[model samples]
Target: MKNLYEKRIDQTKQILAPLGEIHTRPQFGGYGVLADNVMFGLFLQDELYLRATAQIEEVFHHHQMTRLRYIRRGLPLTLSYFQLTDAGWQDPTLFLQLATLALNGARQERAEKQNRERLKGLPNIGGYLESLLLDAGISNQEQLKAQGAKACYLKLDTDDIPLSIKVLYALEGAITGYHEAALPAEKRDELRSWYETRHPTATTKYRR
Candidate 1:
């Protein structure tokens, strides 16, 4: 006695099950399709729209896939999800391949988001630097401040992670809640002096 949308959800789940732990949950007047808990697809009115990142969007474009959009307050708002065409649905191999890419991309985006949250309130600490800090065992703002910028810089250097002297300023700024460019001249000079004392031969100029 399932409705058309309910039956479509079951069909969609079966098609995506090969990617592992496929499930659906109600979302934004539709159903969000999740692979192993990371949402990577959307189902609306029996049409499937796969989640997409910038990289995956290019692939979807190449396949002539259209992005999902809805009218909100008379304005059309396009989303990151790309529709799976009838041909795409008929081809299980291509469908799963794109679905897999979407799932991986979604997972990566989620991880980056979580990492940014973990390092929130730390100036100049975006995803790449956040990862570096996590790799060096400096996971959060409190840990970074407690260890001090010099120690954190040394930890990164010890791990053979090549970073500019600006990172040193960035860490200090993170502690003081100042933008790296806005760091006090004296503090900047002190940090530069410390760096010179440690690695005298280095010639990496400071840039914001």
Candidate 2:
């Protein structure tokens, strides 16, 4: 296996040299091909694979490129990397296009990972808020970002959980990844405006 891989690595480097500085390293039981610090291709199971994204997925599908399927932890898995089509392999210009699209997808994936990491560390958003978000069909930081603070707050209100002003600020805090009280004045005003619109004359009642 090692002997075969050394030859493939040399050939891949030569093929990609015209594009720019290409680097290869081992990861996930395969060798990754990187250009300008972004991995855009891979070698696995004696096949050359390229990263793919929705923007250029149709081109891959049109070529009928086989998707990489493997088994990990006894579970069948599929990755976005697809085998290089014969035409793309033969055409350096087309291969560069594919590699560019793949790098865009990699960057997006990296940004999403950072967002999820930030969400997990949110100060006031915990299991309770997560459940409320789930009930509101707004799971994950991506969804929370898309729905905006006001929309998520109103979605939770429909669940009849006896919420109040604190919950509004909490949603804003979750989106900001800070404690509820730490929100900026402009953001707090936006949340308060939305809350006042919904509850015109409600007073904060402890109901003790």
Candidate 3:
């Protein structure tokens, strides 16, 4: 079954070779062709489909070409695939356009997938920092400066806890801090003292 699929994939590449450079590799269930490392199309059961993007999607609509669906109840999938309109494979220009559209669509799809994956991996911060940042709409450092550190921290009780965690978060914010506001090395050192005080045991273990 695998060998048969490989043969069909090879044939699909051959059919597309004349149009331009076509790269074939195993993907999803069957085979995909990429132009410039961006997926332009795919082959399944020896049929070719091109990616569809917002701008050129209407071209696919006019011809009533089938939109490829990957996952149910997930993102909507669109592609520019068509069976040969005629017996001889006559429309070279149309083929090229469809292939280009597919490639662009695939690039967008891959980018969105990466963004979704990254958002899922955000670290958890305690309620104190979370509420401060959230209330200020400062999910990241860019927003941090606009809100100002002193104001942001005003709500939290500073006297009760050792200063280390606060300093560490500040240092982290400095390293990633946006263009508008960034903590200096001295401020980071002050935070470092808190870290040393709070995590002396753990710090010693790592130092060894």
Candidate 4:
């Protein structure tokens, strides 16, 4: 098994070395390469493959490379994986295109990771409600009022927020908390009191 793994790693290195530095590491019981600390591709059993995104899937299709598939429950599970054609590996331009796609995918993955990490540090409802408000174009209390409660409630409904008045109060609390200074003192206090009344223990607890 070790010799097989080493052979696969060596083959991957030989193929990718010319393009740029390829950093090999074990992942998912196979080997993956990180180009510039961003996973660009993988090697499985001496077969080299690049990461496939929606944008690059077409390129892989054009080159007649088979989409990677695995059997699950006696059914083929085919997703975004694409086998690099022999011509694609030899053609520097095509190799670069694949590399570019991988890099973009890595950037997006990293950004999402960072967002998740940031959310991990925040109160559960903080980011979620902020995102909801941002999606509704209600960055401040003034904007929320401009939209009116019905419009805001409708938008919240579209987002699957419950129609109950209690949920509306929670939503209002979230909005006010995020835009404290923008909200009137009385409205902010009212929302805070409503929230505390609903969940008295939440007043001092930081459950994230």
The per-residue C-alpha lDDT of model 4 at residue 141 equals: 48
Return the top candidate by lDDT: 1
Name the 10 consecutive residues with the lowest summed lDDT in model 4: 116-125
Clashing pairs in 2: none
How far does residue 106 in candidate 3 sit from its true spot (Å)? 3.9
The CA-based lDDT of model 1 is what? 0.76
Residue-by-residue lDDT tens digits, candidate 1, 32-92: 7887877888888888889888888899999889998765323354567899887787887
TM-score between model 2 and native:
0.50
Candidate 4: stretches off by over 4 Å: 1-20, 72-75, 112-208
lDDT of each: 0.76, 0.67, 0.49, 0.54
Q: Is candidate 2 or candidate 3 better by lDDT?
A: 2
- Candidate 3 local lDDT, 1-208, one digit each (tens): 5675566456546666754676876643456677666666666665666656557668776755666654312223322444323322346566555565656666665566444422112333444545434322234444444544433333222223323344345525543442212556676676566456544544222310
Once all C-alphas are superposed, what RMSD does model 1 give against the true structure? 16.0
The collision pairs in model 4 are: none
Backbone collisions counted per model = 0, 0, 5, 0
State model 2's lDDT. Answer: 0.67
Q: Candidate 2, after superposition: displacement of residue 107 in Å?
A: 4.1
- Which one wins on TM-score? 1
TM-scores of all models?
Answer: 0.54, 0.50, 0.40, 0.44
